[model samples]
Target chain A: MDFFSQWVAFQTIVTKEIRRFTRIWVQTLLPPAITIALYFVIFGNLIGSRIGTMNGFDYIDYIVPGLIMMSVITNSYSNVVSSFFSTKFQRSVEELMVSPVPNYVIIGGFVTGGVCRGLAVGGIVTILALGFADLKLTNIFVTLSVVLLTAAMFSLAGFINAVYAKSFDDISIVPTFVLTPLTYLGGVFYSISLLPDFWYNVSLINPIVYMVNGFRYGILGVSDVSLWVTYGMLTLFIVSLYTWAWYLLSRGIGLRQ
Target chain B: MSSALKISGLKKTYGNTFEALKGIDFGVQPGDFMALLGPNGAGKSTTIGIISSLVNKSGGKVEVFGKDMDTQPYECKLDIGIVPQEFNFNQFEKVGNILKTQAGYFGIKPGLAEERAEKYLKLLGLWEKRDEMSRMLSGGMKRRLMIARALVHEPRLLILDEPTAGVDIELRRSMWDFLREINEQGTTIILTTHYLEEAEQLCRTIAIIDQGEIIENTDMKSLLKQLDKETFVLDVQGDLEKVKSIQGYRINLVDEHCIEVEVSKGQTLNQLFSDLSELNIEIISLRNKANRLEELFVSLVENKGAA
Candidate 1:
C-alpha cells in the first residue's frame, strides 16, 4: 500500500484502540486517577509530613515526579498488553493480518495507543499531585520528552508481552512480578543516594530508576544520576524494545498458526 | 481473461503429523460461481484459511488476480475478501462500525467507507440495526453482517466458507440470491457449503476434496451426470395395498401413500409416469429422494476412501 493508505490504516487501529479504552472509562481511566489520588493523600500528605526532606527538596515534591512516572509506566504497559491480547482472544487481530496493512503500521498504531493511555493517566496523576504538593517544572523539554519516551519504551515492552501471551494470565505475570518490584526499588519513593554503595550500584541496573530520576531532574532540577546517562539508557531501551517488538510481530508469534 | 484466483501445489501440515492439504491445485475464473465441497476434516477450511492468510501454508503458490501472495500480498489482499465460517468480529462494536472499521483496515477513506458500509448494510437488510451492538444481532443477521463487512472494500473476488451453515431456508435462499447478484456483476465467488442442494442450485462449477486431495473438479452438470442411478420419491393420492411389479423399473412401496422408484441413466420419467398410470396409482407429487450432487459427493468420497 502507498503512504496515504498505510496512514489511514494506522489511524483506524489507533482510533479503535482509543475507543475501546475510553468506552470503558470506569475500568481503564478512572482507576488510575483514584489510585494516584490516594497515593498523594497517604504518601504525599501523611507520610511526607513525618519525613522532612530528601535530596534537598520537600518529601512530597521529591516523590511527585516519581509517582507520575510510575503511573505512566504501568498504565502504558497494561494498555497495550490488555488491548492487544483481548484482540487476540476475540480473534479480531485477524482483521489486520488479513488486510493489506503492513506489520510496522500495526505495531506503530498499538504503541501510539499505549502512549496515549499512558500520558493520559500520567496527566491525571500530575493534576492530582498538584492538590497535595507544590509541583513545578524546571525544564519542559526534559519533562515532556522523558515522559513520552518512557511511555513509548514501556508500551513497546507491553507489545512484546502481548505478542507472546497465550492467555490473559500470561499478560499480567510480568507487570505484577517484574514491573511492580522494579518501580518500587527504582528510587521512586527515595533517592539511591540513601542506599549503601553496593546496593546503590545495584539500583542503577533497574531501568525504571533512570526514568524516575530523569523525570525528577526535569521537574525539580535535582537528579541522582547524570542527565546524559539517563537519556542514553532511555534511547537504548526504546530502540531495542521497538526493534524486538517489530521482529516478533513480523514473525507472527502467538498470532498465526 | 485472467483467473480471479489460482492455487498450485498448495499444502498444509498441522504440527508434525496431520496433513490438512496435500499439494492441491484449483483455479476460479472471473464471474464463475464455484463450490468447494468436502466432508468434515477434508481441508476445505484449511484452503480458505490459507487463501485469507489466516493459516500459514506449508508449501505451494497462491495468486490473486495474477499477484503472487508471497511477494505481492498487499496487492493480492486488496483484491480478495473472505467471509469465514465462524464469527471473528468484535461483538462489542456497533453493526455499522464493524463494516466501516473493516473498510478502514483496507485503507479506505472514512467517507468512502461510510458509503460502502451504508450500501452493504442496506443490501444485507441491516440498515435499521446499524447502530445496534453486534452481540444483539440474531444468528442470521450476524451472518449477513459478516457478508456486508467482507464486501465493504469492494474486492474483486469474494470467498464464503459455509456462509449459510445454520441459516433458515428462506434466509439461505435470499443469501443465495445476493451471492448470485454479485457474481453477475463480475465478482468471482467461491463458496464451501455442506448443503449439496445449495451448491447444486447456485454453483455452475464444482470441486470436491477428500482426505487432503481433490477427488473431483469439474462442471456441476458433468459431476451430476456421473451418478448412474437416481432414486425419486412419488407421493400417491391413494393407498397401495401391495407392491407392483413393474417389468422395466425397480419400485418400492415406502408406505401406503408414498413410493420410491429407482431410475437408471437414459430412462425416461414419462415412461415411469405411464407405467404408474397403468397401475392405477395417481401421483400427487414427485421429487428427488436425495440431492443429485449429494449422491455424487457421498459416492466419490466413499470410493476415495475405499481406494
Candidate 2:
C-alpha cells in the first residue's frame, strides 16, 4: 500500500477506537471524571487545608499537576490495553491483520487512540482540579511536552501488555499490580523530598516519579529532579517502548498462528 | 487464462509439530469458481489463513495475480478478500460501520467506502439492518454481513471458508447466486465447504484435501467422472420380494417401497428399467443415493488413507 493508504488505515483505526470509548462514555469517560473529582475533593481540599503549604505553595496547588499526570498515565495505559485486548478477544484484529495495513500503522493508530483518551481525561481532571486548587502553568512547553510524552510512553506500554495478554485477567494484572503502586509511590499525593534519604532514593527508581515531577515542574516550576534528565528519560522510554511494540506486532507474537 | 492464485509447496506446522499443511499445491484461474472441499482438520482453514495472511506459512510460495506473497504481501493482500468460517467482526459495531471500517482498512476514501458499503449491504440483504448492532443479527444475517464486509473493497479474488455453514437452505442458495454473479463478473473465487452438493452446483473446478494433502485436484466434471458407479434409490410402484441378478449392476432391496441399484459406467439405465418392467415392477422415481462428488471425495480420502 502507498503512504496515503497507510494514513487512511491509521485514521480509520483511531476513529473506530475513539468511537468505541465514546460510545460507552459512562464507563470510559465518566468514571475517570468522577474519580478524579473525588480525589480533588478529598486530597486537595478536605485534607490539603490541614497539610498547609508544601514546596512553597498550597498543598492542593502542589498536587494539581501530579493529579493531572496521574489521570493521563492511567487512562492512556488502560485505553490501549483494554481496546487492543478486546479486539484480540473478539478476533476483530484480523480485520486489520488480513488487510494491507502495515504493522506500524496498526500500532500507531491504537497508541494515538490511547493518547487521545489520556489527554482527554487529563483535560477533564484539570478542569475539575480548578474548583479545589489554584492552577497555573510555569512552562507551557514543558507541561505539554511531558504530558504528551508520558501518555505516549504508557500507551506503548499498554500495547505491549495487550499483545502479551491471553485473557481479560491478564490485561488488568499489570495495571492493578504494577501501575497503581508506581503511580501512588511516584509522588502523586506528596513530594518525595519529604521522605527520608533511603525512601527518597528508592522512590527515584519509580519511572512515574520523573513523569509526575516533570509535569509538576511544567505546571508549578517545582521539581525534585533535573528537567534535562526527566526529558531524556521520557524520550528514551517512548522510543524504546514504541520500537518494542512494533517489533511484537511484526513478529505476530500472540496474534497469528 | 492466467491464474488468479497459485500455491506451490505451501506448508504450515503448528508449534514445530502437528503439520497442518503438508506442502500442498493448487491454482485457480481468473474468474473461475473453485471449491476446496475437505473434512474437518484437513488444512482448508490453514490454506485460507495463509492466503489471507492471517496465518504465517512455514514454507513454500503463494502468488496472488502473479504478485509474490513473500516479497509483495501487501500488494497481494490488496487483491484478495476472505470471509472466514468463524464470526470475526466486532459484535458491538453497527452493521454499516463494519463494512465501512473494512473499506477504510483497504485505504478507500470515506465517500467511496460509504457507496461501496451501501452497495454490498443492499446486495447481501443487509441494508434494512444497517443501523443495528451486529450482535443482534441472526446467524444467517451475520454470515451475509461477513460476505458484504469482504466485498467492500471490490477485491479481485474472494475466498469463502464455509461461508454458508449455518445458513438456511434459502439463504445459502441466494448466497450462491450472489457469489456466482461476482465470479461471472471476473472475480476469482475459492470456496471451502463441507456441503458437497454446494460444490457440485457452484464450482467448476474442485480440490479435495485430506490429511494435509491434496488427494484429488481436477475439474468438477472430471472428478465426478472418476466415480466408476453411481448408486440410485428407486421407488417401486409394486413390491416384489425377489432378488434379481443383473450382469453389470448390483441391486438390493432397501425396503418394500425402495430398492437400491448401483449402475456402473458404460451401463444403460434403459436396460435396467426394461428388465424391471418385465418383472411387473413399476418404477415411480429415482434419485442418487449421495451427491456424486461426495462419493468421489469419500472414496478418494479412504483410498489415500489405505495407501
Candidate 3:
C-alpha cells in the first residue's frame, strides 16, 4: 500500500487504538484525569496556598500547565509502550508484518495512536483543570501545536521502548528510570529559574524542561526559555525519535525470529 | 509461465554465519496442493517467511503470478495469503472483527469486507464464535479463525504452515476435507507439515527437503514407490530358516515363529512361500515388514549404511 492507503490503515489503527484504551475507559482515560484533578486539589489549591509563586504567576496557575503537560507525557508514553508490547506478547504482530502494509505504515499507525491517546488524556485533564482555576490558552495555535509535538515526541519514545522490550518488566523500566526522572526535573512543578545557577545550567540540557515550558508558554503566556528554541528542540526530538522508530521497524528490531 | 509461486536461489543467512536457507528454489503450480516435507532443520518456515515478505531474504528472486516481489511487492503479495504455524490473530478481538480488520488490511472496503468475513467465518464454523473474544475460543476454533482470516481476501494462492499441527484427529480430518474442497475449486495451496500422513493423504506432489536443499521432489505416488521396494516378514510354524536361499532377498531367521527378509518391489512373497514349501516347511502367515515410506525416509535421511 502507498501513502494514501497507509493513511487509511493508520486511521484504522488509531481508531482501534482509541477503542482499546477507551473500552476500559475507567482504567485508561479516567485515571489520568482523576490524577490531574488530585494534583490540582493537593498541589494547586491546598499546597500552592502556602508556597506562593516562583514564575511571577499565581502558584495554582503555574502548576496547572505542569500537571496537564505531565498528563500528556505519561499517557502518551504508557499508551504506546503497553499497546505495542501487548501486541508482541500476544504474537499478533505477525498478522501485520505479513500483510502488504509497509514498515512505515505500521510505525505510523501505532505512533499516531499513542499521540492521539496522549493528546486526548491531556485534553481531558485540561478540561478538568478548569474546575480548579481559570485555565489560560494565551496562544491557541501554540498550545495545540506544542501539545501535538510533545505527544508525538513521547509517543515515538514509547514506540522505541516497545521495540526493545521483551516483557512487561521491559516496558516499565524506562518509565520508572528515565521517564519519571525526566518529568520530575522537567520544570513541571517549579521553574528552572528557581534552581541555583549551576543547577539551572544543568537543567537546560533536560529535554522535558523545554516541553513543559513550551506548553507553559502555550497555556499561560509565560516561559523560562525562548519559545522558539523550545519549539525547535521539540521538532528535532520528534524527527529523531520517529526516524529511529522507522529504522528499528525496518530492521525488525526485536520482532523477527 | 503459469506458476502460482516462483522462488529462485533464495538464501537467508542471519547474524553473520547461520544460514537458514542456503540457495533453495522451487515453484508451486497454480491450483495444485504442494506439500513441503522436511526434517526439523530443513528451512521450510524461512522459505515461507521470505515469500510472504515477513523475513528479509539474504539473496534471490521471488515472483508471485509473474510479478517481481522486490519491485512490485504490493501487487505480488495482494493475491497471496499466509497462515503461519502459530496462532497470530488478535486475541482480544472477536473472530468477526479479526477477519474484518484483516480484510481491511488488504484495502478491502468495509461492506464487502464484512460480507467476505461472514462467509469465511460461517464456512470455518466460526460464525457461532463471531461475538466471542478470540482468546476465549478453543484452539481448534482459533486455527479455523486463522484460516478464515487468511481466506477473507479470497486469495488465489494460500500458504499454510503446519495448519493441522496440535489439532485433534477429527478436526484435522475435517480440515483436510475442507482444504481439499478449496483446492478442487482451484485455490493453489502450499502446505508444510510434520504430519507425513497428512501430506501423504492430501498432496499430489511432495518435496522432501533436507539440510536446506531439496533432496527429492516428485509426485506423491513416485515418492511412496520408493518405500514399496520393500521388506518381507515370514510367519512359519516352527524353526525352519536355518538354511536360506534367496537371490533377490536378504533373509534372516528372527525366531522360531518368524523370519525377516528385505526384497525388491517386484519380488513376490508367494515365490518365497513356495520355495519354503519345496523344503517341506508349512507357512503360517506373511506380512510386509516396514510401513510404506517410513523405512525409505529413514534410509534416506538416516541409515546411510544402505547408501
TM-score of each: 0.98, 0.99, 0.90
Of the true interface contacts, what fraction does each candidate have?
A: 0.76, 0.85, 0.44
The digit string of per-residue lDDT tens for model 2 on B120-207 reads 9999999999999999999999999999999999999999999999889999999999999999998999999999999999999999
**TM-score, candidate number 2:** 0.99
Instruction: State each candidate's chain A TM-score.
Output: 0.98, 0.98, 0.97
TM-score for chain B considered on its own, for each of the candidates: 0.97, 0.98, 0.86
The sequence of per-residue lDDT tens digits that candidate 2 reaches over residues A1-257 is 99999988999999998998889888888998998898888887899899999989999999889889988999999999999999999999999888999888998999999999999999999888888888888999999999999999999999999999999999999999999999999998898999999999999889999999999999999998889989999999999998899888888889998
Cα lDDT tens digits, model 3, A1-257, are: 66656665666677678888888789789999888899899988999889987677888899888888899999988999999988888878877776777777777778788888888898898889888877877998888898888988888899899999998999999999999898999899999998899999999999999989988998889899999899999999988988899898877878875
Candidate 1: where is the Cα deviation over 4 Å? B237-244
Question: Model 1, range A1-257, lDDT digits (tens) per residue?
Answer: 99999999999999998998899989988998998888888888899899999988889999999999999999999999999998888887888888999998998999999999999899989888888889988999999999999999999999999999999999999999999999999999999999999999999999999999999999999998999999999999999998898887777778888
What does the lDDT read for residue B26 in candidate 2?
94
TM-score of chain A of 2: 0.98
Which run of 10 residues does model 3 chain A get worst, by summed lDDT? A3-12
lDDT of 3 by residue, B129-228 (tens): 8999999998888889899888988889999999998999999999999999999999999899987778878988877777777767778888887774
Per-residue error (Å), model 1, residue A35: 0.7
- The lDDT of each candidate is 0.92, 0.92, 0.84
For model 3, how many clashes?
0
DockQ agreement of candidate 3 with the native complex: 0.52
